[model samples]
Target: MLVYVVDHNGQPLMPTTRGAFVRIALKEGRAKVTRTKPFTIQLLYETTSFTQPLSGGTDPGRTNIGEAVLDAGGEVLYNAHITTRNEEIPDLMAERKAHRQASRRGERKVRQRRAIKNGTITFPLEKERTPRGCEKPIVNKYIRNSEARFVNRKRPANWLTPTTNQLVETHLNAVKDICRLLPVSDWILEINRFAFMRMEDGSILGADFQNGRLKGYPSVNAYIFALQGGCCACCGKPLIEHYHHIVPRHLGGSDGPENIAGLCNECHGKVHTGKLSLDKLGKAKKYAALSVLNQAIPFIYDGLVELFGQEHVHICFGWQTSEQRKRLGLGKTHDADAVCIASLGNGSQPRQIPEPYEIKQFRRHNRAIINNQRERTYKLGKETVAKNRKPRFEQRGHSLESFLKSLSPVWRLDACQVMEVSKSTRYYNSEGRCMPGTVFYRCRRKTPGFIHGDIRRQGPSYGIMPFVCLHIILMQASRRGVMPT
Candidate 1:
């Protein structure tokens, strides 16, 4: 039999006529017999070779070794009897399968355990039974411990009678004293008494102590009690000393505690008179005030001035007011409350107006109003910007092709240059049939239809074996301004 080996370029790779029955050993350790019978050799030559052999024979009479295979005139024979060995193939596959199965089993066990822990599976407990010689379970039996007696059954009626209550209270107070003396006593006598009393009455006392009760105000009593517990109304701090009105009473606002908050002195002062505006209060307080104002500006403005001092207040009667209205050359006949001016002390020089009392009063009343307007405008602008921002390209499902198209011309040109280099190498080696200079060796242990294989080359530059011909072609075309579709 005669055999021939070829490289990726379809060129005759070995020395012609050097040997017969040529054996090609692939890098994956698989060897194939290309020539076997005399008849097969005749068929190969007649169908694939461009020349004819001098005589009919199974042997090519030469050793053929090279980088590519060529159409040599010869009586070539092929066979299917070649065998390759790879001992680790089956073991590796078996190990992979075992690992996969174990992982699946572990996942299933974890899911089952989670289900059971989450009460998705409920198992009935087995009924308890004593041995034949043991006594039956007893009802209404009492077990005595060091501190108390535990009853096996429900307690009797009349557990909270006046006489019993008095006796229990007396004993409980004494026990409390004793616990205080011992310090390390296991019994919590007061807790036990409270629990016993609650259980006996089937209800709790003092739980709704402030229910429906007014504390000199028309607001919800619960908030007043909360205020009394030291929570600040303006900042929700826990150490409040001053009570702030959401709407000042001077503007016909109610004295209801709901509209008032218990605030610390700092928060109270910042509430209306400081740079902080009513609008800058936390969301909870802001929403609460909005509910009271019913979106009315007159009420909101009045509330702002009352909480913030008039001197710093900037708005009144729907306009800004300041002490320097005359210095700006405004008419004296204008209504003092209707005129608009900048707030006095926000780095603005204080003007010496004729009436000091009126100036001081205006400063005290307008501070909060101006700050509130500024804060509201700032918030609106921020929200508008957030709503109008554009979506990012990555978030828009851009494909690789689209992304490449969007790159700058210079980057595209560079990519084309790279592609051209690859394409040149691919076609240069293959004689228009298969890419040359590279060898693909299939694993003997692999399944017949599997394409998994190692890439190799016969030349010294084995470093670049089995090049991706398609990538090279496309890259070349791209460089030439003819990119692949």
Candidate 2:
């Protein structure tokens, strides 16, 4: 691994691979560690600011982003793959909205009770009327206690969805980090702009481009019925009464024809009950990635041009990237594609291929504090009881014998107990050896005290690990490209 360096004034200099030099500099108090993940250092004395021209490349994707930096000699200086949390955002948002709605409903119930006691409710209650067979009940306006504000809520011209915003931010943050770590002069970004109609069918031309799959059809249900040969996709029956969503609506799936399929009532019920799978019926075409990329790419390009000048920022298409990658005989990975993007039109083949840093992004902190956290319950003396249930067992495991000497402490206690533990993952070096770091452990101590005993094969280790701690430490680096030391 190479150690990135910066001057005494905190300006990024070329990174060095010599371990001995860095070690001696640190030993003599001439340098200090700045970042732990990438192992960067900063000089404590004055140094020359002269540097060679370098170029960088970025390959943006829906969930993952690849970045690389190359020196003037075509030597690969740094490369990393970032796995974003785009896939989990929709579910998280749904959970948050659910919690908020529940809290509001509880507050409204309290208000209703108070109003009844105060004789403030003079109006008669009325039942809401909803459409026949609709699952959602139409709520009365008075009982709703809130006016419809969706019409008043206006979105800005540059507004983006939570999913797309997270993706765009991930790409921008990765680029900003690399630019601050190296002296990159120019950047090449590979972004794919897909033709949705052409991708679905290659024969679309002229007037057909304007006419979509549902052009002649009266409705989406009719189109799907015709597409599936007017038969149930699951049982191949002629009775097609229901339109099933191949991808469920809860997970941000759209109502597009590609995601909807014709199904009978029996098959639809079976699908909802998990007896049938979507793949068994027919493979559903997903355009989620395409849609996100189309909206996020323009914002990403504009952001890059604003940060690094318009002249330095360049855009490359997927076809050109594919041609170059094929010519270079590189594998089809985000990192390999990034290398090809960097060396595009420059004929700069990498001297040696190195394992790129695998970085996974996580939310800094959870926002919902009162959400439905799983309650730990265990059989205590033939009766199930919650761990947090209270008149309270606060004694240590060692001292538990004084309370009941006939049975062992483990036998007297339940199998599961609530305890605060750090979330951790194993980190490995390029040599395929695991690096020393904190691991996950369950504490048996009912009260706050030193934990002793085996932690599920992790061995007897003691420490007060915090809940949801940040294991990966980030370094504070300059956000601007190259600055004078």
Candidate 3:
């Protein structure tokens, strides 16, 4: 553990070992405790006006990030791992997409039903182009009568998915905050590479290699047939064969022989189209490790340069750091990788390895519910806010009672089924859209009367279906909606 320090002016300074140094300062009224979470102190009296050239290193990751800040003397000042919250981003995005699609469809239906101007939607369905004398389906009545949008497949040149953009922002934010507090004039980030070229024929790949192996063809695709010992990589067939990229090209697999495999014509097409399995081709994922770290190059690199200035930012490869770690006999961990990375920035400085300070990024644990909500429309939007603010317990006693009491007594009807049809046709439009109908209910709960409109299936008409049957259904969809007269 270390004690964080600040100058008399409340400006951040280098941290000191939590021993006689900090104890003496506190005992002599030289410093006062400012924060207790990380045990930081603020100097009450004037202190040193100088700061050391601190170097920082980061092991950027998808789920968690490892960070370390070291002083010019190679002494560790701060180190900690951070857990990121991108897991729910995808689920939230899917929900948003569903909401947008529903809204668009509702708007489109309303416009068509009212014969209003066709706007808002990007691709309005158009009528079929007919010959001069040929007839086309009637618009609105028989079809949407809108035109199919032809040009809707373009995006801004420089664009990243919403999730990807957020991730990049999170990483950059962490680096910026560290630089502000520490006298960090230098930074190092360890990035991985997809170096299929370095692999040789019959050599196994790391588990992070998505498609496992390329059979026995090596990594070069230029002479795949020649490298396979004049035989098919699969089935040991001496007959003519076709080459295939173990992983599809669009999915990051390159044309190198290491990513190439030999198969018969039939097998080749199947593999390309995903009809044949790689296991059937005798390729195996007998490598150690579940995933390979993806190095975000130009994306993270350019941003770091822009933020820290190019002279301050330094980038290193995985192999270089691994070699360094091996020479130092360090364990394989994010912190160890970061140490090697910081060592590069430390240069020839020969000082004791600074004790790592495990710092984790945490603004708030988990997430606030508001992070998952968006602007809903009308009543739904209001209800959502209320639920988040103060959740109301739904009393089931009068929920369906309100809706049931609004139903008319079907004693006058001859058949129960006719009562069902009348209830529907009278209260709903031909398209089965609910229409307002009169509803008056007096329940013991006096739950404020509401004229709710909903499409009801016919068989459960009031005075037709048994009370118990109706009770069961209302329990399932107990929405306190009554029809407006």
TM-score of each: 0.15, 0.68, 0.50
Residues 1-485 of candidate 3 have per-residue lDDT tens digits of 67788788878787777678788989999988988746788889876757778788887776677777777666777666666665445556766667666756756666765554544332344544443333564333323434533344567875776656656776778787665456677888877654542343345456545554454545455366676766766667775466776765444454455566877776677766768677433232322111222333446667888877889999887788778878878778776667778877776332445445454433332223323333221122223111111222563232222333444766322322332211111121234322222122222223432222232444333332222343333443345543212
The TM-score of candidate 3 is 0.50
Ranked candidates (lDDT, high to low): 2, 3, 1
Comparing 1 and 3 on lDDT, the stronger one: 3
Model 2 TM-score, all chains together: 0.68
- Error (Å) of candidate 2 at residue 398 is 35
Please provide, for model 2 over 1-485, each residue's C-alpha lDDT reduced to its tens digit, 9 standing for 90 to 100: 68899888888999898999999999999999999878899999999998887888899988878888877677888888888888888788898888888767767876777777787653556446454444566654334354443546789989999988988888888888887678778888887887788887999887987788689898988888888898998899998988987876675556878778888999899988989888543334367788888989999998889888999888788888899788878788898878878877255876676899998876644557524343233344565333323223563222222323445678545333432223223232233222333343434565653233222324345553332221321111112221111
Candidate 2 Cα deviation (angstroms), residue 58: 0.7
lDDT of each: 0.32, 0.72, 0.58
Best by lDDT: 2
Compose the digit string of candidate 1's lDDT tens values, residues 357-408.
1110001122222222110110122232111012334444333344446669
Per-candidate clashes, comma-separated? 53, 0, 24
